[model samples]
Target: MTRSPLVLLGKIWLALILVFLYAPILVMAAMSFNASPFYQLPFQFSTDWYAKMAGNQQIITAAIRSVLIACGTTVIATCLGTAASVALFRYEFRGKRILQVLLFPPIAIPWLITGTAMLVFFFAIGIGRGTPAVVIGHVALALPYVIVTVSARLSSFDVTLEEAARSMGANAWTVLSRVTLPWIAPGIVAGALFAFAVSFDQFVVSYFLSEPGDSTLPVLIYTAIRKGFTPEINAISTIIVTVSMAVMFLAARFSKFGGSR
Candidate 1:
């Protein structure tokens, strides 16, 4: 059998790109298992770092905080974004396009800028910095992703289903719950997963919005790194990366991200 040169080149390029993107993460994950606290040569395996990470009160607290914030963000963002997506899908009105366009800034703009703006705005409004502020910022950041994901799934929805349900005396709520929601359930799940991942992995916004004494995992990791790099940091980072990857994998599976709808 013969293969085209271009196809081979493209495969080779993709391989290189994957290596470049994931090599550091793979190295870090491997190093987490290494016994060397300073990450020296021989690479003796040990689970001491994981055990230490489990015991560290600071890390445990930060991890719990991050999980709670992520869950809260997922719920809020998914609800709000799903409602917005349904409205955008079902109705037309003045400023609708403007509203849709507005979803981009949180996504298109860098988190650094968004985080700084949120910090300033919250301070002016007296919210200051805390878990509450971080949750708000995470929801805002996650909303666009949920909206976009749900809207994509909504694109394939049949409008007649709602009309048919309504003709059968189904109220708005009934139709929404019975007809519309089922069709878009996968999207909702995917969007929620995405929201969780966004909030869980979020650093810049959490860093800016969180209090010094109560920081999220990402912020805590940043603080730890400032002091020094240790196997404990690597272990925690590996856990974060693993969770993020799992979340994204579920999202993609539910959303059919790369496949035909």
Candidate 2:
């Protein structure tokens, strides 16, 4: 059977949208392999830029710091967010709606505003700028993502399982550990991955919270770009995009996001 014109048009529109979104990233990744530091075209391929990026101690340090911070944010956000999600799912209390509503501002507000606010708050509280400050800001930003993801997973869970467990003399801890957690494990993993991505890719909050000479990879890249553009910067950027895409891909696979399981 022949397809409808509208269906054909929709496919074409989708293809165009995908191309529009990813074409620049493709070009940047391609340029990272080009030998010319200035991005002069002729498509000459070389790994020199990658090698140089590896050799740069500052970049290496920043990359390591970014990973460590992302890991820390993932752990804290996933644990706290998972607990909050469970609470929101299992119990109703006074101001529960208000608590749920409060989770949005960290996500809905612009990062520039949030970052400046955090900087002021931390200063006022005497926390100041550094890795600790960066971690705090990152966890705050990542919590909403984790909570939302885990809460979505919790939505599909069977409440009868908890009731049955309780009737069988299973304690709350036992039911939570053995039943509820097992059912939502995928969501927890996906949430952790999302937390990692948010913290890893975050620039504005990291910039405000991180101390000078000690910044995350995204912040370091911004500093480098300010000095000048180089193939080395392109190389590092390509790496970041690759890692972030890989993480989201895993998150989608685990969570079955936007698709039926």
Candidate 3:
């Protein structure tokens, strides 16, 4: 079949759009390896920063803490969000729409505002500042992601399969566990992975919610950058970018769930 000129033009436009979007990220990745003492354009490449980052105990510890907190947030958000999605999608209830809107306040409000609000709220409730508060804030933001992803998957599902399981002497729990969940497993995993990523990169919430001892990796990076230009920051950025990419790649690869095309 002959390709239309307009379609060719559209493809070219899209390619250009992608280049525009990713060009900055590519530049940052390149600069991370610059050998110059100062962070400037057109520099030599070196691995000193990477080596240094490997030995920096503070950076390493903060990174580990961030990972742990993000994982905890992911588990909590995914469970609660999945449950909410299941109930909202599969059953009828009063004020369901209102609850859905309420769930989105985290994403709807600006991060600075949300962080401040949480900080004050936690203080009022005597929740204290640190990992526990940070986890709560992250969970609030991440749960919306879970709800959106799982609900999208549920919308495409055939509800009667669940009923069929029930007809075959399966209990509600069995039907949910064995039938409905398997179908939406990909979305659940995708949502949880997304939640983890969001929580991992969170700066505002982490900064606000965490006390002195509970600084997250992003917070450490921010403080380091504030001090002065350093190649170590570049190394940290590279490591973070790599980890985020690996996570997204894995999530995309596994989210297909062996389902029909």
Candidate 4:
């Protein structure tokens, strides 16, 4: 058809973009199961790398620490972000726009600059480099994302519902707990997932903040690659990618994008 050319071109561009985004991940996943340690082709399949990964105590310890940090970041980020979103949405004040604008700098600034800045600030404050420092950086990085997600959800909320609850003699806490929170539950879930993903996948900040004996998965992976590339790297890379994708998928399921609400 005469009109089909533009549609075909759009489809081709989308396919190219997807390949650009996902090709490396696909290749890494493929290599994880390959028998060759050197990333050789003609693909003989094996599970030895994963078995080796499982047996590595250092990797297991790092993985647990990563999960714990991500969980902590998620909980703190979600609660604070959801509350901030509500306050921002429910009230109007001078410099409120300025406050909202401030959130963007953390997200927009280069991670290298942010990471170094965090190190300097934490050192000045005596926190220094460690799990606490990493959490502080991760929460700062993740807070904006959670605020944006929950704010987007809150944009569709009806103010009259809160007014009606207040008219019925419900207190501030009662109205928020019974009305606003129920409506924003999906957004909170999605925001929490985003927080978890951000912290779990973080590298630069964690690299600067984590002490030598302890590191998050991404930081650990970077150190391993610097030493040498191995199939075990591929195995862990595949797992990280898989787990991150799974978290985002669940986030999508809980978001308004999923058509649940």
Candidate 5:
């Protein structure tokens, strides 16, 4: 069969889009290794920036805190968002639409507004700013992402398997735990990883919520950048970009929707 002109054009368009998106990252990664202090270099290569980043204890501490906060937010958001998605998709419930909309406001709201609201809410509730505040902020921010991802997976899911389990004397909880969970496990896992990455890379929320010593990696990077645009910042940025790409690639690879089985 001969391909149509429209199909050929569409393929070209997609290829262009992919190039547009990934080109900058490739350039940034390359520049991270440039030995020159300026963007226009004598083209020398060095690992000095990477070494400096490795020696920066503050960045390491900030990264550790970011991991801890991201883990907490991922756990909370994944559980709540997955449960909400499963319930909404699998069962008929009253006010389900309203609840769904409520869960998604964080995505709709501007990050600045969300950060301000979180700060206010935390203070009003007498929760002092720190990891606790960051946890709450990241959880709220990531819940919408989790809900969207899992719900999309569930939308394409086969419910007959769940019904079969129920007919075999499995209770609602049993069906969910055994049948439904396995089918959508990839989506849940992917969403959880995305949520963790979002929390890990978060800057605005952490900036607003964190105490003096509770800076996340992004916040630390920002502070470092403000001090001066050092080559070490490029190194950190390259590392972060590399790690994020690896994570997202792995998440997609493990997804059943991606045909990994």
Candidate 6:
């Protein structure tokens, strides 16, 4: 059987796109294990970079901070975004469309602008720059993604199921806990993972909101890069990429974003 010219061309294009997207990450991961400090290529494998990263208190501290912030952001954004999504799905209000539109600007506007605005707002309210401000900033940045993700999952949900549960003597809370949540559980998980990734990888906003000597991993990595790149940086970066990719991969599987059942 002969493939159509257009189909063959599309496959070739997709292959090129995949290479373009992933080749740099592959190279970076390779270099992380390379013995060369300067990333000298003809690679000699070693775990030295990983060892170096472990002892670096600065990186370790920043990494812990990053995880904590991401966790906080995920919890706050998931709860709020999920509740908001449910409300949007179940209710009709005068400003329902406008309320939905409000979620977009945090996403539509560039983060730099949003970050700077947050800096100003926090300062005006005396929150100042620190982990608190960073968490707030991250949640704001992550909320829209969460809302959109859960909302998409909620769209295909059977409202009649909830109605049936109510008819069968389930209260609102019971209906939500048993009937509604189970069906949309995958979407919530996907949304939470997305929030974690956004907070974990956030640099620009974190940079602006974080206090001196206290910043997230991405901000620390940027500072390290400016000092001069090292194999340890490559190793840590590889870890970050691996973790984020793994999370999004799981999220894709759960959400069936690729249309897999």
Q: How well is each residue in 1-261 modelled by candidate 6, as lDDT tens digits?
A: 578999899999999999999999999999999998877878898999999999999989998889999999999999999999999998988999999999989988988898999999999999999999999999999999899999999999999999999999999999999998998888899999999989988999999999888988898889889998888889899999999999889878777686645
What TM-score, over all chains together, does every model reach? 0.96, 0.97, 0.89, 0.94, 0.87, 0.95
lDDT of 4 at 179: 98
* Candidate 5 per-residue C-alpha lDDT over 78-160 given as tens digits, one digit per residue, 9 for 90 to 100: 99999889888977879988988797678877788989888898899899688888998899899988888899889888888
Who is ahead in TM-score, 3 or 6? 6
Q: Where does the lowest 10-residue lDDT sum fall in candidate 3? A: 250-259
Residue pairs in collision within model 4: none
Question: Candidate 4: misplaced stretches above 4 Å?
Answer: 257-261
Residue 193's lDDT within candidate 1 is 98
Which regions in candidate 5 have their CA more than 4 angstroms from the true location? 1-20, 254-261
What clash pairs does model 6 have? none
**1-261 in candidate 2: lDDT tens per residue?**
579999899999999999999999999999999999888878899999999999999999999999999999999999999999999999989999999999989999999999999999999999999999999999999999999999999999999999999999999899999999999999999999999999999999999999999999999889988998788889999999999999999999988689655
RMSD to truth, every model? 1.4, 1.4, 2.9, 2.1, 3.0, 1.6
| lDDT of residue 105 for candidate 6 | 93
Which pairs clash (backbone N, Cα, C closer than 3 Å) in model 2?
A: none
Clashing residue pairs found in predicted model 5: none
Which segments of candidate 2 are over 4 A away from where they belong? none
Worst ten in a row by lDDT for model 4: 252-261
Worst 10 residues of 1 by lDDT: 252-261
lDDT of each: 0.96, 0.95, 0.88, 0.94, 0.85, 0.92
Cα-based lDDT at residue 177, candidate 5: 82
Better structure of 3 and 5 per TM-score: 3
